[model samples]
Target: MFIVFLKFSENKSLASQFMDGHNQWIKQGFDEEVFLLAGSLQPNLGGSIIAHNTTLVELQNRVNEDPFVKESVVTAEVFEISPKKADARLNFLVGA
Candidate 1:
């Protein structure tokens, strides 16, 4: 699994743009069973997303295409996540 941490920079305001594009991603089919979970950190500092079984290349590509990235509203860091035991309460697992 991969976890993407996005830290918004000063290029542009991220919240509204990000939310619009995020919702569009969900509507588009990226939300089917791959993303796992996504949301922003409180205070709108940045955002984080958990994606299952995806490569770094794929994650980068997705981020590149995201409106926030495309519009230069935020910068991101992608990390490989090793969850010893995923919590079902958070619905981080697909189809949970």
Candidate 2:
């Protein structure tokens, strides 16, 4: 599994032009069973995502395709994770 941490440079703001594409990517990720959880930090400062069973390369490629990344709205750091347990209430478990 991998955790993708997105830190949008303070200089940039979310772009309306990229919103739709970003939403689409989120949908696609969910459909592909890769994206586990995603949300932004408080006050809309950066974001974080959990992707299941994905390689850093694959995650980077996926992020590269994001309109936010393409437009330089945010930079990302990817980390490998070994989740000992996932909250059932959140539906974050890979296999339920």
Candidate 3:
């Protein structure tokens, strides 16, 4: 699994301009079953995504394609997680 953070950048003001494309990219991630969750950061920091079923390289490439990232509206950082345990409902993540 992975946690992807998209923190606002100096060009944050441009966010509105690319939001539509960014949203479409996010929808595609879910449609492909790679993103398990996506939401805003507190205090309007930016956004985040919990993703799986992909390699770090692939994920990085995907993130790079985000309009927010491409247009410098946000900076993307991806963290890989090796789950040792999880609640029953999330057990798949542990084994994955």
Candidate 4:
């Protein structure tokens, strides 16, 4: 899985300017079952997303297409995690 942070840039205004397109990009990820969860960060700074079904390199390429990244509204920082354990209901997250 991956924990992705969208850190706001100095050109924060671009976020609202391109909000629609950014949302579309996010929808695409969910539609493809790559993103499992997402939400805004504290104090409205930016946002975060939990994703799977892809590799870091592939995720980077996908994030690059986000309007937020394209218009300099935010910079994407991705951290990959290899799950070793999970609750019974989510056991599928960590496979043998």
TM-score for each model: 0.72, 0.78, 0.99, 0.94
lDDT of 1 by residue, 1-89 (tens): 77887778796555584678766864552545667777887786777777765667877887777777777777888887666665677
Off by over 4 Å in 2: 84-96
Top candidate, metric lDDT:
3
Clash list (residue pairs), candidate 1: none
**Which candidate order results from sorting by TM-score in descending order?**
3, 4, 2, 1
Looking at candidate 1, the ten consecutive residues that score lowest on lDDT are: 25-34
Q: Model 3, 1-96: lDDT tens per residue? A: 999999999999999999999999999999999999999999999999999999999999999999999999999999999999899999999968
lDDT of each: 0.70, 0.77, 0.98, 0.91
Best by TM-score: 3
> What is model 2's C-alpha RMSD?
3.0
Better candidate number, 3 or 4, judged by lDDT: 3
Q: Against the hidden true structure, what lDDT does model 1 obtain? A: 0.70
Better of 1 and 4 by TM-score: 4
In candidate 4, the residue pairs with backbone N, CA or C atoms under 3 Å apart (3 or more residues apart, or in different chains) clash, namely: none
